[model samples]
Target: MRVLVTGGAGFIGSAVVRHLVNDKRFDVLSIDKLTYAGTLTSMVSVNDNPLYRFENADVCDKTAITQAMSDFRPDRIMHLAAESHVDRSITGAKDFVETNVLGTFNMLECARAYWQSLDSRAKETFRFLHISTDEVYGSLGKEGLFTESTPYDPSSPYSATKAASDHLAKAWERTYGLPVVISNCSNNYGPFHFPEKLIPLMIINAMEGKSLPVYGSGSNIRDWLFVEDHAKALDLIAERGRVGETYNVGGRNEQRNIDVVNRICTLMDEFRPEHGPHSRLIKCVEDRPGHDARYAIDATKLEQELCWKAVENFDTGIEKTVKWYLENEWWWSPLRQRYKGERLGLLPSGA
Candidate 1:
């Protein structure tokens, strides 16, 4: 299969690209804008593969995206590009709306045009998969998991835009007859993760003996998924999932923010005994604006429909993630220089 993957240099995107090229041996065109969160270093494993080609383009550029669609003649399009950091979105919602909302529109229009141009058999085989997050469902009441039928009640600027994009994808399918499938995933932590996120931030800070910052008493809960597992789920959804269907992919590993921090500390203590008792570095800080109390996804639909299961639970996933950072200093060291774990999403003094 020939696949065109957007944002294929970012965290989850790179994982998907690597799996497509190395595991499935699919002909892949990896397109990315190389934003702050996107680094080419993540795709080094398969960069030289003949089946893996890279395109440095933005989804918001309709002309460029359309040109790529025409040139690549992709049988499948996995749309993963967006401004995805919640903290960054809080500080800069315009970029989120522009990229997530407007960019998705461009992708849908381009996909519709391309889908319309294909032969009957090619059209039947075409799939446009839009990858999204579970944060669109807003905070759960500590009782229920976010199912495919859950109403979207986004709490952050980031998630609100993603929710908008999700609706757009469905609308394109319903109104334009574009073959679109969406997947809403939970918190993802694994190798090549940008350090600004929770797990990586804690691990990097603890290694440096810097203060490990936790937000709002660190009681907030998130269902964590391994990125590699999420990559596989995306591939399965793109290849075999039903059109116009929404799938929730999760690791079923629910962990409190504080517990997650402590677990990283325990693992660090094993790897870097000199940084013994990293838990002592934990420092509770101000909560983010409109912080969701909890987020968990029900992957029943995906598991039953696609026969997919997350291979890594919280403990195993966390260990693998921590060890990756400990061993691969070359990958993360440069990122640490650029982003030093400073607090983001805070309003200026009295804004």
Candidate 2:
């Protein structure tokens, strides 16, 4: 099947592209804006593959997205493009609103028009898979997992915009009869992850013997999912998931913020014994504004309905992730020059 993947050069998007091109050997057209986070080098593995093609276009561009949809004539449209960093979103939300909200609105409208133009068989087979996040469900207390039906109570501009996009996707399906399936996933980490996020940030800082900043008391919890596993789940949802339904994909592995950092440190120490005891670099810092206390996804619906299972738990995934950074400096070295481990999301002193 032919698939058009928006944001196909970013971390999770690249993973999906690699999986579809290498594993499924699907004809894939990757459309990305090449934002600071969306680097084409991430998809170097399959960039030259016969089945893979890429276009440097922002999803927010109605003409570009509409043209790509018309040109690719894909069986499935996987929408993964957005401004995804929480810390970055806190500092500048306009970009998030523009890309996540407006971009998604455009994607939905374009896809609806394209679907309408297709013949009966093509329309029936086409799927618009909207990738989303668990953060839209807001902060969870110490108890309970976020189900597919959880009411949205977004804590940050990032989540708020993503929630708006999710609503737009569902409304398109309901109002316009667009065949859309939504997947809200937990935190994704693995190879090709940008250095700004938690896992890679800690790993790189510890490697440089820099302080590993832990926000607040580092008690906030998050459910972690391997990026490759998420890529597979996305493919499954696109292929067989029911239209207008929501699926929550997670690794079912929960860890506190401090614990996750310490784990990365431990793995780093094992891999680079010369830089032993990396945990000593840990330092507490003020938390970001409206930091969510916890987030955990209940993926029972996805598992039972789609027969999906995560291959990597936290321990296995972290080990592979640390080793990837150590061995594949070729991919991340340039990114480090562009984005060092400086703190973000800091409000002005008076604010």
Tens-digit per-residue lDDT, 1-351, candidate 2: 999999999999999999999999999999999988889999888977989999999898889888998998999999999999888888789999999999999999999999999999999999999999999999999899999989999989899999999999999999999999999999999999987778887887888898888888888889999999999999999999999999999989888989998899889888888988999989888878899889999999989999999999889899999999888888887887775545562211100
C-alpha TM-score for every candidate: 0.97, 0.97
Clashing pairs in 2: none
In model 2, which range of ten residues has the least summed lDDT? 342-351
Summarize candidate 1's per-residue lDDT along 72-182 as a digit string, tens digits: 999999999999888888878999999999999999999999999999999999999999999999899869999999999999899999999999999999998899999
RMSD of each: 2.7, 2.7
The local distance difference test score of each candidate is 0.89, 0.90
Clashing pairs in 1: none
